[model samples]
Each structure stands twice: as C-alpha cells, then as structure tokens.
Target: MNAPLTSDASPRLEDFPYRISDNVRFADLDPNQHVNNAVYATYFETGRVTLVKDRSHGLMPEGLSWMLVRLDMHFRSELRWPGTIEMGLGLVKFGRTSVTLDQVVFSEDKCVASAQAVTVLIEEATRKPTRLTSEIVRNFQPWRRRGVNVASPKF
Candidate 1:
C-alpha cells in the first residue's frame, strides 16, 4: 500500500508579481495631479520587496546584501493619482554575484513604465562583492527567459 503525497505550494500572484493594494495616496500626488518621478522609484521598490517576500531567494544572505550597481529606466507613459497599478517582476540574468531584474508597471492594460536594475551581491560585514551561492542560482533558474544567455563572470 502506498501513501498519498501532500504538496507544499508557494504563493502566486495572478496579475502582478506582487500587488500593492494602496500604492498612490492623496499625498502621493504632485501639484499637477500626477505621481512625481521620485515617487515612481519608490513604488517600484515597494513592488520588488513584495515580489520577493516568498520567493526572492538569494543575493541577500546572513552577511550579504544586494547593492544596486546600475539602473535603466524607460518612461512609456504616465500614472495619475489615486489609480492602482501592478508591477511585474522578471529576471534577465543571475551572475556569480550580480542579478539583473526587469520591473514593469502597468495600469489597466497599458504599460506605464519599465525599469532594469543590476544588483551585485555584497558582504554585509566587508561590503565587498561575493559570489552568489548555488541555492540562489537554482531558485532563479526557473525565471530566466529563453535566449537571455547571461555568461558566467570571470571576475
């Protein structure tokens, strides 16, 4: 006789990688009734944290933190005040001590903004670069899109 197996599942986001219920508040608006440029970065950061709450494995370990080495952003459209938006999280590559993340913001069906960030793993104590462990590599493998070949670093 065989016993039935039970399953442990991870939390899934239906629309966005991680949805923030109340992103833009009354105070979040500029005098023009539009969210300011600085606010957009804040919102994106919020989404990133939520996206990795359950499965944002690796990079930051007991003595390490991800340092943002570079950021590339493209403003496709604008987002007004008091509107809800969803931020999508995707991975482009994961190197020895760096990871490239793709974050996109959408309101309704339209893409509002897109940003790319390259983060490097740093030691919390020494504040120097460190190689990402295999555990993180395995977890992020599933999110790597096809044809996005990120080469192994020689450094």
Candidate 2:
C-alpha cells in the first residue's frame, strides 16, 4: 500500500517570477498612520503593468491595451509607511478576450493584501474585447494557474 500525498502542488504567489517593488509614502498613509486602502489598488496596477511591459514574456502584442473590468480584493493587514511593498503577480485565469490575474502585496515580509482582477484586451478602434492570439496563449501557458485546466468563461 502507498501513502497518500501530503503536499499540494498548487501554484502560489511565490510561483510567479514577476516581481514589483514600491516604497510606501507618507502621503499614502491615512489618519491611522498606515497605508490607505485605496493605495492597494495602485500597487496591484503597478504589478500588472510591469508584468505586461517591463517584464513581459514576449507573448503580448507590442501595442496591446487592456481594459480592467473588475477587481475583487481582500485586505489582510495594515501596511505601514516608509516600507517597501513587494508584489507578486500570476495568471489565474485566461479567456478568449480577457485574463484574470491574482496578486499579493507584501510589506516587511508580510502579506498585506491580495486581489484578483479581470482585464480585457481591447481593440483601440472599436474599444471592444478582442480574442487572444495563439502566440500569446502559447506564451502564457507556462504561467497558467496550476490546478486550472480551462480558460475562464467570463470576462
């Protein structure tokens, strides 16, 4: 008889190779002296932009643009000022015209927040969602969510 596996092979935040860092500013703090809640969204945006531009894996088209459709976030801990926020980004779901990305923000080596965002690739002329090219799909396959086998149905 064989023992069942104890460890799960699911992908985690650390599985994402893309990294983005930013320093919390005094202006980012509220009366509580912690980073404002709204600033978390900006951090995630910076991660996404960096993944698509600075650290892009050469999958996306040169001029590809995105339209963020929705963002579901959870704030786990307070982020203090004068600290660095290290963000990790991963592709949680891929669709015909959109992609759902999962991100986690770390401050002082602690996870402060996590978010899932749906962003659609849009055509500049029509301002509408466009299908992902085969090349892009191939390039993103290595980063697909570990347990997800199919693309998400919704944008």
Return the TM-score for each candidate structure. Answer: 0.74, 0.81
- The residue pairs in collision within model 2 are none
The 10-residue segment with the lowest total lDDT in model 1: 6-15
Cα lDDT tens digits for candidate 1, 21-57 = 4456777778888777777777667756654444345
lDDT on C-alpha atoms for all candidate structures: 0.64, 0.75
- Model 2 quality (TM-score): 0.81
Top candidate (lDDT): 2
- Tens-place lDDT per residue, model 2, 27-59, is 999999998899889989998887766435765
Model 1 accuracy (lDDT, Cα): 0.64
Model 2: weakest 10-residue lDDT segment is 4-13
